[model samples]
Target: MKIDTQGDTIRIYDFNAEECFRIARRLENQSLKLYQGIKAAIKDADIAAALDILIAEELCHLAYCEKALIDMGVDDINAEHLVEVVDTGVVTPLAQADIERVLCNRQEALKLGIALEKRAIAFYESILAETGNEQGRIALGNIIEQERGHRERLQALIS
Candidate 1:
């Protein structure tokens, strides 16, 4: 999306709505898989419950993205984008044991999540730069904030 910046407020528009939506879908899918892995890996009841909650949250995220696409008049939300795939990395399946082992060795998963979020933030920021409009900038900034939230949430889990 394109964005115009004025102080802390930004106005944004002119975004590749389809591309963003596609990215969102892929990211949500990745999150769901990660949580599934964590759920399988963690033997602790509390941790397993927490991972399940995160999985549910990602489901909501996917639904929210779908809704956003519909609201923006972007049809066919499943279309894949090379940028989303390449930039976000391959959607690998994490075994429950592999993810469960992470509770004691959490750095691996935490760092991966952080990297994914960073890439997502950069992608949206780049899109905003392309648009170079007020509304687009605003929208991209909001996305950046959202990515930060993801980072924060993941950090809580890891650290």
Candidate 2:
């Protein structure tokens, strides 16, 4: 299912509630992996420490998505099935190849973190706009607020 953003409205094509939860969980897991990769690659103690915090945040986000799936009546969430869901085209701030370059310095790492948080906030807002389920909307709203807080913390770190 493709999620299209046309002006102010978001169009979710042929997605059921279960599929939506799967997509969300998949995206969160991808982000968690990205943060973990970056944290592993960074050598600077300070940058590594900062990334450690973001890694924890991403893990929490992933858990929240999983909980949302369970709340949607999905008893057993198969990770393989989640990976097969339609690609939502959620972009990470730094690609795998670019991770080394972007995370070379503290400032750059913080900038990447800020960009990632912004993208996550936008993605969740779009999903929230398209979701008809009240529970899903509430979950998305909470996630968005958390992403905003992450962005603000990254901004503070940079400044």
Task: Give the candidate number with the greatest lDDT.
Answer: 2
lDDT of each: 0.63, 0.69
- For each candidate in turn, the TM-score is 0.60, 0.73
- Number of clashes in every candidate structure? 18, 0
- In candidate 2, stretches whose alpha carbon ends up further than 4 angstroms from where it belongs are 1-11, 14-20, 79-84, 92-98
Writing each residue's lDDT as its tens digit, candidate 1 over 103-126 gives 754465555566556676776666
| lDDT, residue 103, candidate 1 | 71
- Tens digits of lDDT, candidate 2, 2-89: 5669899866644455665666677777777877777777678877877777777777767876787787777778746633454667
* Pairs clashing within candidate 2: none
Candidate 1 off by > 4 Å: 1-15, 79-87, 90-101, 105-119, 126-139, 153-159
RMSD of 1: 8.3
Question: Residue 70 CA error for candidate 2 (Å)?
Answer: 2.9
